[model samples]
Target: MKIVEIGTGYTQIPAKIGAATEIVIENLLNGLNNNGIEHTLIDISYSNQVKNSDKFELSLTHYVNVPNWLNKIKDNGIIHIIRRIWYSIGVGLLLRKLYRNKLQTETYIHFHNQFNFFFAYLIAGRRLRKGKIRTIYTVHSPDWSNSKKIPKKLFFEKIAILKADVIISLTNIIKDRIKESVKINSCKIIVINNGVDLNKYHPIIQGDKQKQIINIGSVCKRKNQLETIVNIKEFLLKENYKFVFAGKIIDHKYFNEIVSYIHSQSLSEHVKYIGEVKPGSELNKLYNKSMLYISHSKQEALSLVVLECMAANTPVVLSENFETFVDFDSKIRNAVKIISNHNLINEINNLCNNVSYHKQYALKQMEVIQEFYTWDNIAKLMIKKLAQFKQTL
Candidate 1:
C-alpha cells in the first residue's frame, strides 16, 4: 500500500523552527522511512531549505510551490483562506496525476489540518469516493471543544471529520469529544498520541540543576505564560527561582502585558523571554539544563513540547486545563505534576524540595516516553491501525 502524507501549507516540512504540526509530519515521515515503509510527503516549498535533505529518502518527498505572494500572506486572514483553497486544488490535481490509471484503493492521503481536509473534499470528494481512495484526517487540536456554539471554522472542521475515512485524535479525551459532538462512526476515530524524537531528546546526565523553570511555546494568552508568572510571583520575589520563557512571540499584546507586568513588579531579574529557540540540539539542551518544565496552556489536544521535555528527562508540571493526560496510565499520570490555581505553588515547592523524588520522576517520564511516545512507535501504531481500517473498507 502507498501512503501520502499531506502537510499543512502554513509551514515547510522538516520544519526548521517551531511549527509543531509540521514537525510532527517530519518526524512521522522519518519513522516511516526507518520502518522501510514506502510513502510520499507532500509539502510547501522552502527556498532556503533543501526539500529532501540527507535525512529523507529522496524519492519519497514532493513539494508544491505556491505563489510567492500567497506564501507571504499572513495566517487567519481571508487571503490565507484563498491560499489554502488554492493549495488544496493543487493537491487534488497532483493526486489525480499521480494515480491517473492506478487503483485508488492502493493509495491513502493523510491530512493534518482542517482547512486542507475541508477544501480538498470540496475539490476532489467525488473522485476520492468513487475511486475508493482512503483519506485520514488528524485533528491536531480541538480548539472548539469548550465552545458554546460552533464557529464558522469549526463547522468546516466538523464537516471534514464526517467526510474523512478515518480520524486520528491525539488523545482519548479528544476522541470522546469528537464522538460526542460529531455524528461519525466511533470505529473510524482512533487515539494516537503525539510523539518525540527519542534520538534527539534523550536524557542528559547533569549535576545539580539551577533554580530555573522553563516554559516553551508561543508567547500568547492561550499559553498562559503571564498567568504562570503571576501565580509564582511570591517565589520569584522571595526565592532564587528564575522563570524562562521561550518560543516565538505570537501575540504582541500578550507579550507586552507580560513584559510590562514584569518590569512594573521589578521581576525583570527573575523573568526572561528568550524568543524562539530552534529545535534539535538547542531545544534538547534547553530541556536538559532546566530544573523543571511547566506548561500553563489553557487548551491543547496534546503537547509535543511536554512529550519532548519528558524525553529530555525534565520533570514536568502542567496546569489543570492541560488535560491530555487524563486517560494516560496511572503511573505515567503520577510521573508529572498536574496542578490547579489552588495547588500550583505548593506542587512547585514540593517538586523543588524533593531532589530524590524529582530525579525519580524524571526517570519515570523518560521511561514512558521511550515505551510509547517515540515517533517510531507512533508511526508503527498508525500503520497497524490503518491496515486494519482498510480491511473494513
Candidate 2:
C-alpha cells in the first residue's frame, strides 16, 4: 500500500504541523522493514528533490509565485489573496489543473490543517466518489468543524471528512467531539496517541539546579501562561525557586497582565523570560536545569510538552480540572496539584514540597508512553487497520 500526506496551511510549518508530519514519516520509515509496502508524501514543498526510497516518495505542489500572484497577496501584507479575483482566477485554475493531473495515483492525504482538508475534498471530489484514491482526514482541532462563524465552511468540511475511510484522533476527547459533529461512528475514528523519542529527551545530569522551572510553548491566552506566572510568583516569595518562561511571547494583553502580577508579587529577579530558544539544544538545557515543568493551559489534547517532560523523566505540573485528567486520572490525582486561585506561588510551593515522589508519576507516565505512544506501534496499528480496509474494499 502507498500513503500520501498533505498539509497546505501557512501555520502547517509550525510546531504542531512539524510534530504531526514528523510522526507520519518517522513511522513510515520505521515500517520500511516490510519491503512490500510503499509510501509517499505530497505537499507544497516536495515538488522538487523528492525522496528516493523506491517505496517512499515526496510529491510537492507548484511553487507559489510571490508578489504578483493573488493567492500570495498576504505572503507579507495583510490581504487575503484567496478572496481577490484576479490572482484567485489564475492561481486557482493552475491548482485545479495540478490536482487533476495527480488524481491518477493512489494516495491518502493526512492534511495537517482544516483548510487543506476542505480544499483537498473540493479538488478531488469526483475522483473520491469513483474510488480513484483514498483519503484519510485527521481532525487536529474542531476549528472549522465547530465554529459558529464558519457554518458555510462546516458543511463542506463535514462532507469531506465523513467521506474518509478513517479518522485518526490524538485523544478520545477529540474523538467524541468529532463523533458529535459527524455521522461517522467510532469505527471510522481511531485513537492513535502521538509519540515521543524516549531516548532523545531523557533527563540529563542533575545540575546544581538553582531555583529554575521551565514552561515551554508560546505565551498566549489559550496557553494560560498567566496562571503559571502566578504560580511562579507564589513560589518566589515562599521559596527561592526560579521560574524561566521560555518560548516567544504572544497575546500581548494577557502577557502584560502576567507581567503586572509578577511585578506586584516582586518576582522580577526570580521569574525570567528567556524568550525563544532552540528546542534541540537550548530548550533541552532549560528542561534539564529545571526541577519541574509546569503548564497552566485549560485546553489540551494529550499535551506534547507534558509527554516530552515525562520522556525526560522530569516531573510535570499541569493545570487541569477534573475533566482534563480523564486519561491519566491516577497520575492526575497523585502528581497534579489543583490551582485553587491565581496564587500560583502557593500552588508551586505546595507542589515543590514533594517533587521527588511526584517524579515517580512522571516516570510511570513515561512508561505508559513508551508502551503505547511510539510511532512504531502507532504505524503497526494504522497498517493493520488499512490492511483490513483494503480487504473490505
Candidate 3:
C-alpha cells in the first residue's frame, strides 16, 4: 500500500516544521523504510508549486496561492479589514475552483495545524466524491491562529474537520475537545498520541550542569515564558539561573512589557533573548546544552516543544492549564511539576534539586513512547484502519 503524507517542509537543512513535528515523520519513515512500506511525503512549498520527494513515490510542494490582493498585508490595516471581510466568502469558492481540474487520487490528509485543514476542506471537500481517498488531520496545537489581525477563523476549522474520513487527534484531550465542540460519531475520531524517537531525544551522558533552561516558541503572550523568568527570579533569589527564550517577538507591546519587567526587576543579565533558531545542528546543540525545557502557555493542545524536551532528556516544567494537561500519563505528570502560577522560588528550587527524579521520569516515559508513539506504529494503525474503512462504510 502507498501512503501519501503532506506537511510543512523540513527536508531542507533549516526545516520550518518545528523539531517535534519533523521528528514524528522521521521516526515514521524510519519504521516504514525498515518494514519496506512504500510511501511519499510532499512538503508544502513557498513558490506556489509542488516539489518531488526522494523517499516517497510521489510528492508535491504545492502552496496555497496568495490571492493577488492578500487582505492582511498591513501598512495601515485597511487591507487586513478587507481581507477579513473577503476571507469568509472567497476561501471556499477559490480553493474549490483552483484544484478543480486535477487531484483525483487515493491519499491520506495530514494536518500540521487547523488552518491548512480548514483551507483544504473549503477548497477540496467537493473533490472527495470523485475519488477513493482517506483523509486524516493531526493536531499540532490549538489553532495557533496567528496574529490577532487574522480573524480567529475557528468556524471553518470545525466544518473542514467534520468533512474528514477520520480525525487523528494528538492526544485524548484533543479528541475530547473536538467532540465537545463538534457533534460527530465518536468512532470517527481516533487518539493517535504524538511520537518521539528515543535515539534523538536521548539524555546527555556528559556529566555537566548548566544553569540555563530553554523555553521555545516565539516570545509571545500565549507562551507565558515571562512567568518562568519572573518566578525564577523570585525563587532563585541570587538570580543565578538564566532563561533562553528562543523565538520571534511578534507583539511589540508584549515585547516592551517583557523588557520592562526584566529591567524593573533588575534581572536583565539573567534573561537572554536569542532570536529565531536557524534550524539544523545549532538547534540540537542548544537543546543539548540546556538542562531543562520549560513552557508556561495559557493554552495548548499538545506541544511539540514538550516532546522535544523529552527527547533531549531535558525535564519540562509546564503550566497546569485545563485544556491540555489533563490527558498526559500519570507518570509523565508526576515527572513534571505543573504549576498553576505559584510561588516561583519554591517551584524552581524543587525542580533544580530534583535532576535525578526528572531523568528517571524521562527515561521511563521514553520506553512507553517508543512502543506506541512512533510514526511507523501510527502509520501501521492507519493502514489497518484504512483497510477496514469499507466495513464501517
Candidate 4:
C-alpha cells in the first residue's frame, strides 16, 4: 500500500521544525518505513526551492509571492491557504488527475491537520464517495477548551470528524471531545497516542544532570508558564532548582509579562530563558539533564515532549486539572505528579525532598514509556487499523 501524508501550513515535512503535528507525522513516516511501507509527504515551505531525496518523495508549495499579512494569518491558523478558492481549485484538479490513474484502494491520503482535512474534503470528497481513494485524519486535539473557542474552527473540526474515512485521536479525551461535538460511532475513531523515540531520548549519566526544572514549549499564555512560575515562586526562592524555559515566544506580550514577573520577583538568576532550540540531540540533552519536566499548560492532548521526558527517565509535573492524562496508563498517570496552582509548591517539594521516590517514579516512567509509548509500537497499532480498514473495503 502507498500512503500520501499532507502536512499542515508549512513545508517542513517529517521533522520537529514545525508543530507537534509535523513531528508526529515525521515519526509516523519513519515507523512506516521501518515496517517496509512506502509513503510520500507533501508540504509547503517558506522558500521556493524544492528537491526530492531517497529518504522520501516531497512535493512543496512555496508562498513567496503572497502578501505578508496573508502569510501571517495562515501561519497563525486564522485562515488556511489550502481552504482558499485558488488553492482548493488547484488541489481538486490535481486529485482528479491522479484519480484517473490509480486504484481507489491502492492509495491512502492522510491529513495531519484539520485545514488539510477540510482541503481533502473539498478536493476529493466526491472521489472518496465513489471509492476513488481513501483518506485518514489524525485529530491532534479535538480542541474543546476555552483557549480554542473559535466557532469556525469547531465547525471545521466537526466536518473533518464526520467526513474522514477513519479518524485517529491522540487520546481518548480527544475522541470523547469529537463525540461531544458531533454524533459519530466509536468504530470510526481510533485512539492512538503520540509516541516517543526511546533510542533517541534515553536516560543520561546521573552526574550529568543538574538540579534543574525544564519546560519546553511556546512561551505563551495558553502554556500557562507564567502562572506556573507564580505558583512555585516561594519554592523557587527556597530551593536551589533553576527553571529553564525553552521554545519560541509566539506571544510577545505574554513573553514580556513573564519576563516582567520574573524581574519583579527577583528571579532573573533562577529563571533561564533559552529561546527556541531545534529538536534532535540538543533537545534530547536538555530533557536528559533535567531533574524534573513541568508542563503547566491549560490544555493539551498527549504532549510528545512529556513522553520524550519519560523516555529519558525524567519525572514530569503537570497541572492537577490537566484533562489529557485520563488517557494515560495507570502507571504513567501515577508516576506523573499532578498538582494545581494552589498546591504546586508543596507537591513539587514533596517529590524533591524524597529522592528515592523521585528516582522510583523516573524509572517507572521510563519502563512505562518503553512498554507503551515507543513509535515502533505505535506504528504497529496504526498498521493493524489500516489493515482492518483495507479488509472492510
lDDT winner among the candidates?
1
Candidate 4 per-residue lDDT over residues 255-338, each given as its tens digit: 999999899989998899998877767788888888788877876777888888888877899886575434666766877877
lDDT of 4: 0.71
Off by over 4 Å in 3: 8-35, 46-106, 113-126, 141-152, 205-207, 322-326, 340-344, 384-390
lDDT of each: 0.80, 0.56, 0.59, 0.71
Model 2, residue 237: distance off in Å is: 2.0
> Tens-digit lDDT track for model 1 on 101-219?
64834677889888777776777676667564788899886574454345676877888889988899887777777888785799999888778998889877677777889999988
Q: After superposition, how far is residue 270 of candidate 2 from its true place, in Å?
A: 2.3
How far residue 87's Cα lies from its native spot in candidate 4, in Å, is: 6.4
Q: Mind giving the per-residue lDDT tens digits that candidate 2 earns over 161-254? A: 6777777776666676667756566777776665565545666766544467878777787667777676556556567777877665657787
For model 2, what is the alpha-carbon lDDT of residue 84?
A: 26
Candidate ordering by TM-score (highest first): 1, 4, 3, 2
lDDT of 3 at 228: 69
TM-score of 4: 0.86
Q: State which candidate has the highest TM-score.
A: 1
The collision pairs in model 3 are: 40-56, 49-61, 50-61, 50-62, 51-61, 201-311, 235-345
TM-score versus the correct structure, for each prediction: 0.92, 0.74, 0.76, 0.86
